[model samples]
Each structure stands twice: as structure tokens, then as C-alpha cells.
Target: MDITSPDNSYEIVIVGGGMVGASFAYALSQSFGGTCPSILVVEASAPLSDKFLQPSFDARSTALSFGSRQIFEALNLWQILEPQVSAIHEIHVSDKGRFGSTQLTREELSVEALGYVVENADLGAVLNEKLKVSNHIDFLIPASIQQISPTPGGMDLSISTESKRFNVSANLVVLADGGRSPICKQLGIEQSKESYQQHAIITNITFEEPHNNIAFERFTENGPLAVLPLREFEGENRCSLVWTTAERESENLMGLSESGLISNLQASFGNRLGKLTSIGEKFCFPLSLSIAKEQIRPGLVLLGNVAHTLHPVAGQGLNLALRDIDALVTILKTASENQQSFGSMQTLQTYVNSQKFDQQKVISFTDVLTKLFSSKKLARIATRKFGLLSLELIPAVRKRFAEQAMGLSRKF
Candidate 1:
């Protein structure tokens, strides 16, 4: 093995620079009192200065729950990201060709807006921009981790960039490199995956009428469709669409012409937003429930999709991850203040324990919703109707449901 001298060592090192990982780095840096801990973030994809390739930082839109908004504001990133986001004043959820439907509005929840939708690429730009000026964070892009070894006091990592190879050691290694990361596999971190046999076709579609900042989540015969409102571009009413269907149907849909696909969308999602005028390019990806069986091991920890990948039914994937990030940052800041070994099993376990409940709750909720709403059985249909009705008519139930959708749990 060609082991060279260490390039540098850090108190903390994040293995990915996607949403969750990048946010954690910034949050941790901002929370420090005086001297911030030395932090390093390694990303395989090219930096924003070049061509970025991380799927998590793509053209697809991500819904930021109200709680996620708070996290950003607290980190002082909201100002940079707010311009690219569209506020979701209301969420209309219904079963296609069914009688019962529910509408959750910001007014009813007593919030300015339920959530905000921002393009992944735009958010990435903001994050990368911050990284460029971050004094405490050493951000490296177009780099990959070849191997990781647990050390007595910390962890040693071998990374490759271009034709160069180097090593770096850190007290902790945060694995936020997305689901199905080979590094996690190499570490023998078991993952339990439940394939949904579904694929989501995501795109942006312009509608005839203004979205009026209203989002729609309609459960159809094939699957669920979400139309999240977007900021107007040149006075055009736009919305980001996530249409989930069977894998086979998704393949067929991808081949359809723009007008054909728009027709299919209009058919599945009613005329609530008037006619579909135009659509951007469509992209499809499989859906599943994949959770890391073990989140922490000695000097290593998992974050973002690496820890859990959920169905995007409730737009809870990123929201839940952000919440977990918040908890991890809280724990790490306290550990730093106390001069504790942040990589110790005890400190890492504290993070795992704190994030365990929220992770499970959100995962179970999304998984159940995926199965329940995807079914066409009479009993399931009736249950779904009841679910929507209860969510709307009952005050207490509505509040709880709203809290879940807005990512406001007890932890917050």
C-alpha cells in the first residue's frame, strides 16, 4: 500500500457536501463561541466553480418544511436561499376520483406559509458560495474517499483527487454521501431496504392559471402526484411536479411527448391549476425505503440519505434529514464546548439516540403512506378517505398532521 504522509487533520470531517452535509458544516461553524473547530468537507462531484454532478444538487426542486426554514435562518443561509424559493401558502391533498379531500392552509396552521420550494441546484450554489468564504471549513470538491480506517483517537481516510493521493485524519467521519454509497458498503454498514417498485418522474410544468402559492398532493389510481408551486418566471405560473407511478408505467411515461405527458398529468391531477401549458425535461428515479442498520461506529457516523432514504410522498425526505442534522450539530457543539472526544462511542451514540426516534417516525410515516395510498383495494380506499377526512375535520388531528408535514416534532 502506498501510504503517504498526512495532508492535514481536522477535528471534524464530512464525507459529502450535499444538502445535509453542507448544512451541518455551516451550522457547526456558526454555533462555535470563539475559535471554531477545524472542519473539512469532501465532495466527489465538481465544485460549483466547475460542473456540479451530485444528484442531490440538481435541477429538481426540494420542498423545505417550515422547520427546515428555521434551520436555514438560524444558520444565516435563508437570506441567500430565499430568493430562489416559492412559498407554499396551502397544500391540497386528495384521492383522485374519490369523494374526500383535505386542504391544509398556512392560515389554518397560523403560519405565514406551510413551506418553501427551492431548486436543488440553486441551493447548492448558495452552499458552495458560503463554503468559498468559510474560514473554519476546508471544502474540497472533485474528490473521493478511497478507504477509511478507525484509529485509536480518531479515523484515518485515504482520498484521491485527480492524479494526486493523500491522507487525512479526523476525530469523526460523517457519512453523508447519499444512499447506496459504496463507502458505507466497504465499511460493512448494513442497510435494510424495501423497494417500492415505483419510479418518480420529476419535472417543472407551467400552468395556465397562477398556482397562487398552492401545492397539490393527489393520490391517483396509478400513484401519488405532487405539484409544488414555484416562483413566477417572467409572469408565468410554474410548479415542480413529482409524479410517482409503477416502474413500467414510468418508463412508458418518460418516452411520451411533452404534450402527451402533460395530458397524462392533467388527467391524473385534475384541473385544479387549470391547463398545463408547458413542461421542462422529465427525469425518473426509483423509490424505496432504505435505512442504515447502524448509523454510528466508533469514530464514524451517517447523515442524510446515507442514514435513511424515504419515499418522497410527504416531501419529508430532506426535511427529516435536516432535523437530524440539527440534532447532530447540537450534540457536537456541546461536545466541543466540553472538550470531549467528539468521536468517542458515547458522544456519537448520543447523536444516534437523539436522531433515532425522529428518523424512525418519519420513515415509518412515509413508508406507511406509500403503501396505503398506492393501494386500490376497497378497504384501503375507505381508510384513505377516512384519513383525509380526519385530517381535515378534526382540530387536534389536523394540528398533528400539519406538524408532521411541516417537520415540527417535539425535538424542535
Candidate 2:
């Protein structure tokens, strides 16, 4: 749909309308409070009625830390999305073939829940609905950015739409498409990537017993596996499973029959919730650590997975990106109030500086968890046991771990 008038330009343009990009649009519009700059969102694909149509919002589930819930509350979107989520009241962590384990409860953290797990489809529906009702956002869907050229005052984007080809200029361009964005490559931005030689199998599973809203993180020789609580389906105890294993192993498991897979899963993860009676669709993809070295430049910025894609071991990837969006909104609002160039290196650098610590800390934490838990050596096992016990024995250590995992330690 050719909605934009000829010669019309925007003050800011968001290249992706995925979760992070949509959240940034909403947060920025809310920050301006009806007196906002002209904003445009160029989305390559139409808003999919079936969430699985989009890779970013699919059959998988996401764990929203308490801090993320608050951020949603600030934007007034939490109430609409809350009922679709299953609260994570407690977290149980263990190591296979080991003796040490630890537990984190909401009571210890003084929160109603440690986190909430919601289907990717549910979240995508909420975000799409919110963006639809927003008057300040001009979203162009089924469009792609053919090329990008940096201008003195702003950036120029050559966008290809179904109807016609057009060019738009914006004072600021936010690249939140994803980690593997071709737009980044067009702009000459380079990302340094490190592959883990592992893959995660994601699916929704049903168990015989009640999960009691407890999330489980089990370390195995293959990789870190997580089972997050999900809302019950048809009176069955449901959970979202992320099982990490070597690439070849993942391929073999994905080809097995449902019964065979369930049997194997039960072996790795004891029958904590009794038998895994059934499972929904399955998805598997190779895991890696991709970090864009340069995230900001004059008239441009990178957000979300485009900036950094982390291992799923900690469920901190999206949570960390939301935090980055929050910081960018704060910086942009302040810059607007001061009449400074929001896309200037000075302004963008401020955001980079403010979020550096939080980003690095989360990245380091997840990386360490992957390397430590992925190990099968005696020393690594002993260290992991000590780590688990420390979390159990020391309230302070537990508190810090919980706070970080809950996305509390880096609140904007």
C-alpha cells in the first residue's frame, strides 16, 4: 500500500517491525506523549496473522523478566498481554550426573514472579495490535530497503514496496531488523560472529504432572537445556522446552519418532514433571554468538539482534535488547527536549555508553554459562557444583543471580 505522499519524509525510521523494533516505536511515541516527531517503520513482511509466518515470532516461547514486564507496564501494554503469560514463580537448576542444584523463588526476590513465559504468537499479536492502534507510527509493510546511503543531515533509504520503489530520508535510522540483517551489510557494518557448534531444539511439550509454574534449567554434556512453564492446554501441564545438543545429535533427534524423542528427553531430564506425554511442533537451529562491533554512527543506530545475538542458555537475548531500547528512548527524548541532533554521534554515543555495562555483563554471563555447562570434565563439574551450591548456600549470591536473571540489576 502506497500510503506515504510524495516528498514526505520522517524524522526517524525503524527498519524492522519485529518485537524489539515495535517496542522501540511504542516506547518512543509514548515518550513524546502526542508531541512526537514523524516516525516510520519499514517492514519487509506483512503482519502475519499466523505468528509462525515470521521467524522472530513463531511457535517458540519467550521468557520476559520482571523488568521487561515493568517496561511493558510503562507503555500500558502489560495488562493486555498479561493474561496470555504463565508466571515463573520458581526456578530449579541442576546438573546431570551431578549432585549439586539450586532453586530461586519469588519469595526470595520479593517479587510476584521471577518471570513470565508467553508464546511468541501471543506476544506478536499484542505488539501488532498496539502498533495498529498507535496514531504516531506510519508502518510500511511488505517493503524492503534496497540500499542505504548516509547523508550529511540524515540517511537515505531506497525502499522497494509491492506497488512502487521510493526513497525516504530520516534524521535517524534504527536498524532493529535482526542479527543477520542484509541491510547492515549494505551499510558496510560488520559483525563478528562465533559459532558454538550447537543447536537448540524448541517445542511445546506436555507432561503428566503439574509443573507448578516452576522453570527448570538443567546442564548436560551436550549443552544447557531449559524448560520454561507455559499456560496449561486442555487441562494438561504444558511447558516450553529448549534442548541444546551438538549439531549432528540434534539432527538425529529431530528425525526420531515422538515416542523415541520423549524417551530420550526423559533420560536427560529426569521425570521432574513425570512423563512427557506429548509434544507440539519442533524447531531446530544452530546456535552462535554474533556481536556487531560498531553499533552507532552519525545519523544511524543498530538495535536488537542486529547489535548482538546471544546464546539462549540464559533467556537474556530479548530481555537485554528491550533494556537497550529503553535506554535509547531515554536518550532520544532528552536530545529532543534539548533540540540536539538525535542522530548525531554524540547523542548515540551517550546511549552506547549508558548501556555498555548492562550489555557486556549479560553477554559475559550467558557466554560463561554456555561454556561452563557445556563441559563434561571433572573440573568443570566440580566448579559447576560449587557454583550451584554457592547459589543455594549464600542468600546474597542467590539474590544477585536472581536480580540479574530477572533483569532488575540494569533498570533504566
Candidate 3:
């Protein structure tokens, strides 16, 4: 129980115990009950804090779909997060070209809300707190993997802390490491990394209106701009904005003073919601489309950001990751009940096949949407205009897109 010591071995080893890893661990613990399997989590930093404090309240946030929220509830972490979460009740999509736009309401779909937004730190804290209460899960705070090797029947990992080295062996090893995962590369799994010419500038802004649980997404020549609903204090309403633009423009925008930045935002975006009164500190991230060529290997499987990193055009990156987790957990449940080896090639193949369609759907959708919205070529521009017009005119197509945006395309 001492933070100074490390567990010697485990039946399952997870690398990168961030939100993604935490999700898998929580699910596995629940599905198998406390007596399930010996598990150890090797995280990038200490259990709670490395560079940031617990519940850091950092600028990063995610729009979790209703489906994903259910997954959290199944794992018992949602109760801890629900109090801090902000529900998205409505959404509007528009474009600035000849093409018009379409709007969607939760009422149209007969759903309580479109989605929920929660701070990244709050989500992480909830997962870690559950792990703390789980006697079956061993928390390796502030450790990194020094070596990973595949044996004939199992995988071996050597992890280290400042004071000592620890050896861990698992029948199955899951890579939940974030994008550009060293574990994936070390296993010689190929990845397709397509760098984009754009960057996303993310920040929180105080709007004149209360947002009223509405989320706005406007497509522009540069890229798509999204305003997500968020809550700061008990009585206040705010929106978390992720605006994608060309690299140069993003740099310029990040450098602007608070007032100047608000002015520019107001100009680019008309007063539909009223003026932007104030802005929060801005953060920027390079955009890219990354998908692993292989999703599984002998005694190893990849999930989460380690599996695929899509552009944030629709904010479904994490949702897609949760889907992967959902499918994998289902496969594992069946295999365990049938007394099958979880890391066997047969089990791995089943997990891979179950996820093939969903993964392809998300990657392809984001790729095509980004290219369509960011194009400035005359032909491409005209095509997007017509596409937008179609969306406005066709109720069925608009509903389909809206449902997809709400992360309801697949029932699971």
C-alpha cells in the first residue's frame, strides 16, 4: 500500500492509465467481479499527479455521447462524474458559403439531451478513485515501462520507478497509451499518420447568452468551429470552444490579447448567441489522422488513442475509443465465460472483427468531413455548398447526420 513500493507481477498489464486506460480497467474489474484477474496499471506519471494537480481543471474537455455516458454508468464511475457534468441539450450546424445549414434538437430525436461535457481532470479523478477502492486492481503510481517483450505463451514487461525495477507478466497486454504510442511502435505495428495543415485552438469563452444547453458548430473555409456547453460554477453557463484554422491563423489568434481575441471571434461569428464578452487562455494542438495498421497482435491488443487518433472535427475521438473498449469488453466477457484464453489469436481476432466496422466508420467520416470543409478549390467549394444545401433540404439526411453527431449511429 506504500507509494514507495511496486507490485512484482500481474495477470494483465495496462500501459498508460489516463482516461482511456482507466476506462478499460474499470470495466474489466466490474465484468469479472473482484475475483476476476490479476491486473496492474503502469501509468506515465504517478497515480494522480505528475505535471498537474488532481482534478487539474485544465483547459482540456470532451463531449461524451449518451452512449458513452452509459458505459461510464455501467462501470460505476458516472455517478462520481455526473454531478460535475454539463448536459448538451441542443446543437446547430452551419456553413458560411453558398450552402445553407441544418439544426437538430434533442426533442426531434426524443432524447433527454444531445450529449454531456465534462472536464478531462474530473473524468480522470473519478476513474482513479474507483481504482483506489478496488482491491483487485493494483495501482502503480508514477511509473513507466522500460522494456516489453513477447514470450511464447505470454508477454513480459519491465517497469521502473526512481528507486527500483519491477517485472510484470500478463496473459494479455493492452496498450491504452495515447497517440504516438511507443508500445505500438515497439511491437512493430504499422500506423498511418497523415499530418494536416491545420491546428485546433481550444479555450473557454463567456458568452452574452446562457447558451441554454445549445452547442453550435460552424464550418468555414479554414476549418470547422465548435462551441460545446460547459458549467463553471453552480449558477453560471459557459461554452468550451475548439476552433480549427490554418497553422498561421491559429498562431496569430493565440497571440491576440483577450479583448482583441473576443473582437475577432465576434467578427468571424455573427451575433447569433450575442457578443463574446470574455475569453479564457488559449491552447493549440497540431491536427492529424492516425490509425494503426493492425489492431491486435499475439498476447497484445491496442485500444484508445493508441489504436486511432482522428481529427477533432466532430469531437468523436474519445467516443470512438469508448466503442472500441465496449466491443473488446464484450468479447472478453464471452471468452472468460467459455474458459478461453483472453490473449489467444482466436479471441484477439474476434475483438478485431467486432471493432472493424465501427473504427472504419469513424475514421472515414472524420477524414471526408475535414477535407470537405477545409477545401477552398472552386470545385470542392461548390460540392460542399451543395452538400450543405442537401442537408438543409432533406430532413432524413439531416437527421442521420445529427444522430451520428450525437454518437448514436451504432446502438452499442
Candidate 4:
């Protein structure tokens, strides 16, 4: 089955050229041949968008787990990212509930570091740099898909840019288009989702005391607050923060002036790291968990936020997306080599089967943990607090939890 437009031909067409999509494209390229898989990436943001590739004046950053670091290393993208990455040597987790508190240290697990803290822009720049040098992938910058339809053989995509329209076809179509996946909606892939009754407010902060490579997670009556360490700020130490709270509370916080907000934060957060005198402007995202009931369809598949978007409370969203990239690359490489129909129902089903256990495990774990911690119930509050307190006393349990945060749990 030749799934290609007569004018422009390709073996795979990936929608949404964000980091996840780019990673998948690069992975498939390497698996098949250094420069073999004919691919096209359509991104709402330009494939070569400066938003991520430029320097990091942005307040946004992400905590990359060790498992994700290894995956990037395997993909040959980490070396490019190393300079901008900051290692997380320790983590402190505590809950202000009816029970007690807990903390996890990297030394307890005999690991060099728990994970790495990196700005989103830096990671994107590194990935874009690699994508530019790759001979295998073709990036369709700043393009939008107007329509997507399944053909008897594979799939058809109609993409429009400012100046032109591109009609593309591929043996397999990957809808990496994000949470509100237009392709999935076009294909009628059902999804099950729930709201977390919270919002995550992200910002960068310059602390009075040096972080000293320690990250902190403090849970209050509102929601969890994560303070992640950075390498060096100008000449002092700084940290990135993700403060989760209810929508109303989030709005009120965001409404404050920088100094006012900082003052309020210092009050609840305490002077654990001395005074937090300054903070970058705040960004807010509503919290929700979404899972596609069926990630694969007749001629298309979903990845990243499109397939499953989880609560950022655990910071596993991108890690899970990377796992999807790995599985898709493996399956596609084998199929392409065997001359098998890449878009066949059989092939898509196999990819879905391989990902089921791992995907479900992550979604369930994050969802349950988020709900358990967010509950205000007296009983649940006590149990969760006790759970944290108990783990604090047991060295082994605390180590295990840290290992999990490092993305070294049973499931990848």
C-alpha cells in the first residue's frame, strides 16, 4: 500500500513538531537508518520556532528524571543538553496535615544525583539543534493541519501554512498534537478525563540563601509546592517553583504584585532557605488528567499530551511521552524492515499493546497520588500524613520513593 501523495512522498508524517514529536522522529530515523525514514512534522509553533530554541529568559523549566536523562542520552540528544542541565542532589518532601512529614535524599539510594533541573527553552534548543543536523527528518515549520482522513492504504493530511497548502500522505500518522488533539477528535478517538480541582502556578525565584543543590516539596492546606534547584544565578543560587492550588486561590495569588506575592509566599513557605525576596512573573495552567481510551486507530496513533495528559504534580508527563516515543520507534523500525504495512490495524494494535501496561501504570499512579494528597478528608489526610511520616522513619522506603522520583520505578 503506497500511502504517499503523488507530488510529495513520505513514509511517516508526524503532527505537532514539539519536543516529543521531534524525539519520536529522530528515534525512528536512527532505528531504521541514520537518514532513512522520510518524515514531516507540522507544528503550530514553528518547527524551528525561536520560542524554545532561543536563550532562556523564560521563567518555565522542567525536572527531568534520571530515566528520561538516560533515554535522551541513548537518543544522542543529551550531550547537546548537558551544559544547560543542573543536577538535583537532594529532595525534601513534607506535608502539613494531621499526621507528619517525610524527606528523600539521593545519598540514601547510593545514587550520584536524584535528577536534573533544566529550563524548557534550553531542552528545546538542544533538540532543535540536533533536528537541524539530522539528515533523516524534514521539519515543516509553523504549519497547521486543516484536515486529516484515513485512506484505505494509510492516511491523508492537508496542512496549510501562511503561503501554501501541503497535501501529505504516510504509511503511519502520529497525532502528537497535544491535549486538545484535533486529529484524534477528527478520528473520533474517545477519551476519559477528570479535573484535579487545582491549578499549577509556575515561576522562577531568586532565593536569599543558596539552594546548595537541594530541591524541596512542601504540601500545605492548598496544594503542593515544589522548589527545584538551579546551577547558579548570576552569582547567587536560585530555584524554580511550581505552586499548585485551587483555581480561586491561584487567581488571587496571580493577581498580587511581584513583591506582594513574594511576601505571601515567604510567609507560607517559611524561611527554609532564608528569604525569597524576588520572583519572576507567574504562569498558570489548569490541572487535569486525560487518557485516550484507544491511543491507536485504523491509520493513526496518538502520542504525548494527545494520548494521555497527567497531573504535573509528579512531573512525569514528559517522561511518559518519551516512553511512548521509544515504543513507537521500536515497533515502526521492525515493521519497516520487514516490509510490513506500517499503518495496518495489526501494527497499530501491537504498538498499543506494548504501551498499555507502562502507560496505565503511570497514569494510575499519578492520578491516585494527586487525589490522595489533595483530599481534605480527616481520615485520608491522616493516613497520607502517616504514610509520609512512616516512610521518613524507614530508610529503605524513603530511598525507594526517591528512586521512583528519579524515574527508576518498576515500570519505565
Q: Output the number of the lDDT-best candidate.
A: 2
Residue 202 lDDT (model 3): 89
For candidate 4, what is the lDDT?
0.78
| Candidate 1 vs candidate 3, TM-score winner | 1
Q: Clashes in model 1: which pairs?
A: none
lDDT of each: 0.87, 0.88, 0.80, 0.78
Worst 10 residues of 2 by lDDT: 1-10
How many collisions per candidate?
Answer: 0, 0, 2, 0
Ranking by lDDT: 2, 1, 3, 4
Q: Which stretches of candidate 1 lie over 4 Å from their true place?
A: 1-6, 47-53
Cα-based lDDT at residue 9, candidate 2: 75
What lDDT score goes with residue 332 in model 1? Answer: 83
Off by over 4 Å in 2: 1-7, 48-53
Q: Candidate 1: lDDT over CA atoms?
A: 0.87
- Residues 60-133, candidate 2, lDDT per residue (tens digit)? 89999999998899988899998899999999999888888988999988899999998988888777666667
Error of 4 at 112 (Å): 1.8
lDDT tens per residue, model 1, 1-412: 0112224798888998898888888888888736688888888877444335476787689999999999999988998888889999999999998888889999988999999999888888778777768877888776888899999978999998887888899999998999879999998889999999999999999999999999999999999999999889998999999999999999999999988988988989888888899999888989999989899988898988998999988899889888888888889888877888889888888988887788888988898899999998999999999999898789999888888889886544
Q: Highest TM-score: which candidate?
A: 2
Model 2: residue 284 alpha-carbon error in angstroms: 0.8
